[model samples]
Target: MKFMMTFHWVPDTEQRAEAIERFLRTGGVPPQGVQLLGRWTSADLGSGFDLLETDDAAKLTEFAYQWSDLMELEIMPVLEDAELAAVFGRVAKK
Candidate 1:
């Protein structure tokens, strides 16, 4: 399954500095079982998005916990356009 994670951080300078330091130290690596497909950051560096794929939901929770202290994260399961189309196709045939 694929997950789209959006993260937002506060305007506190101290918190932002700590988050940056942690990211620099860890490279924002995901845990085992979760593969990071891509990531994008806002121009103001206050928010970002991450696309990840994983089979185990627990790993997703763990991955989120790793950064939970620094930012608020919203994780949602997502599907590709073709995948959604195939689901609709099957439903239409039924």
Candidate 2:
């Protein structure tokens, strides 16, 4: 399954700096079970989005926990456009 992980950093300079430093040191890689598709950050560096694919939701949770202290995280399951269209097609056929 694919998931969208959105994050908003805490409104604190020190925390943001620390998170950034850590990211630089660690390369901001996702956990073992999660495959990162793409990552985007807001122009102001306030919030960001990540597209990831994983069969194990627990890996996402673990990844969130790692950064939960410095930022708020929202993990949401997502489907590709074609996948959603297929669902709609089935409904229309019914």
Candidate 3:
């Protein structure tokens, strides 16, 4: 039960940053089994990329909700190598 968490801001930079910072400090999200992966933010500088590993859907859902309430956010699954290969199948012959 892996979950990917994304953040999309629906407010001004200052407000957004404040929310994010607060989340980081008190979100209750587990620090173990999570990776930062990669991130990109050209505006507001209030964005991050996180790779989360959890087997409990309930916990993951709570984590997502916490982020959503903090800032306008979006999250989606990022499959692992095996999962990605299974979904995409073999590469086309060239």
Candidate 4:
């Protein structure tokens, strides 16, 4: 499945900076089973989003846990447009 993960930096500027440095130093690796498809950050740098694909939900949780101390995260399941259209087609035919 594909997932969208949003990361919102903590309100403290210093802490957020430190966490970002640490993540960069560590190469910001995602948890096992989770593959990063893309990433984007807000212009102001307060928040970011990652597009990831994974079959194991636990891997997503573990990835979130790794950053839980530095930022708030929102994980959402997502489907591509063609996938949504396929679902709609099935329902329409039924």
Which is the leading candidate under TM-score? 1
What local lDDT does model 4 show for residue 10? 70
Error of 1 at 32 (Å): 1.2
* lDDT per residue (tens digit) for residues 1-94 in model 4: 9999999997898888888798888767797799999999999888999999999999999998888888999999999999999999989766
Looking at model 1, how many pairs of residues clash?
0
Residue 45 of model 4, lDDT score = 86
Provide the lDDT at 27 for model 1: 93
Q: lDDT values of the candidates? A: 0.95, 0.92, 0.62, 0.90
Better of 1 and 2 by TM-score: 1
User: Residue by residue across 8-75, what tens digits does model 1's lDDT show?
Assistant: 99898998999999999999999989999999999999999999999999999999999898899999
- Runs in model 1 with CA error above 4 Å? none
* Candidate 1 lDDT (Cα, 0 to 1): 0.95
TM-score of each: 0.95, 0.94, 0.58, 0.91
Spell out the clash pairs found in candidate 3. 8-72
Better of 2 and 3 by lDDT: 2
Query: Highest lDDT among the candidates is held by which one?
Result: 1
Q: What RMSD value applies to candidate 1?
A: 1.4
**How well does model 2 score by local distance difference test?**
0.92
